[model samples]
Target: MEDNIRNSDRAPLPVGLYPHARKVGGLLFLSGVGPRKKDSKNIPGVELNDKGEIVSYDIETQCKSVFENVRMILEDCGSSWDKLVDVQVFLTNMKDDFSTFNKVYADYFKDIQPCRTTVEINALPTPIAIELKCVAEVSS
Candidate 1:
């Protein structure tokens, strides 16, 4: 069976129309998660204009917040951090933000390291600096 976690009170709502996480077979797929606060428009480490264009950002802070969102989703879905198998990271400025974001990422996954790929992009749907889309194995 396939299941979707949408608009979950345990995690921040996705900025776009999408599920926070979806389970198919024995794996869970998380959507590209940004650092937006739950039930609020504020984004950590991001300065947005009235039109929601990014003005400035701190990658480390944003990365931490994104992981926190992922953590919440994992917990609610009967999974754990160590279950993560892969992660895809999106950064607006790889040359400038990669190191800081990597450090923050290592702090969380120090031992349970998940395979990761990072890429730089010109923009995201929101004014955030980073997004994390990942897959995890679920113990059924």
Candidate 2:
């Protein structure tokens, strides 16, 4: 069974053609969530050119925002940080950002400690430095 949580104000709305989160088979799968705020086009740590390429970025700031967004989504969906089982992090510049990203991530997940996979990517749909997608057990 699948249930879509699309009307959530806790997390930012989907930035593209997708729902914020969907519960299927007792697990909540979240879309790739960026650091952009709801109802706005600004990315917290991103400085972009007119062409949408990165001019500069602050990975630590982006990491904090992304995790907070994910946390809010879980709360709104009746879950919590401890319920998260996995996370996938996509970084535009792992070489430069990984250490900062990792530090900020530890600050969030050091206790809950979800399994995570971090990967380097060329870019995301937005001009942000990082994006996070995760899965968690759906609480009753």
Candidate 2 residue spans exceeding 4 A from truth: 1-7
For candidate 1, what is the total of clashing residue pairs? 0
The models' CA-based lDDT, in order, is 0.83, 0.83
lDDT of 2 by residue, 18-115 (tens): 77788776788888988888777788887989897888888888888898888888888767778999999999899988988888888888988889
Worst 10 residues of 1 by lDDT: 1-10
lDDT of 1 by residue, 74-112 (tens): 877767788999999999889998889888888999889
Clashing pairs in 1: none
In every candidate, how many clashes are there? 0, 0
Off by over 4 Å in 1: 1-7
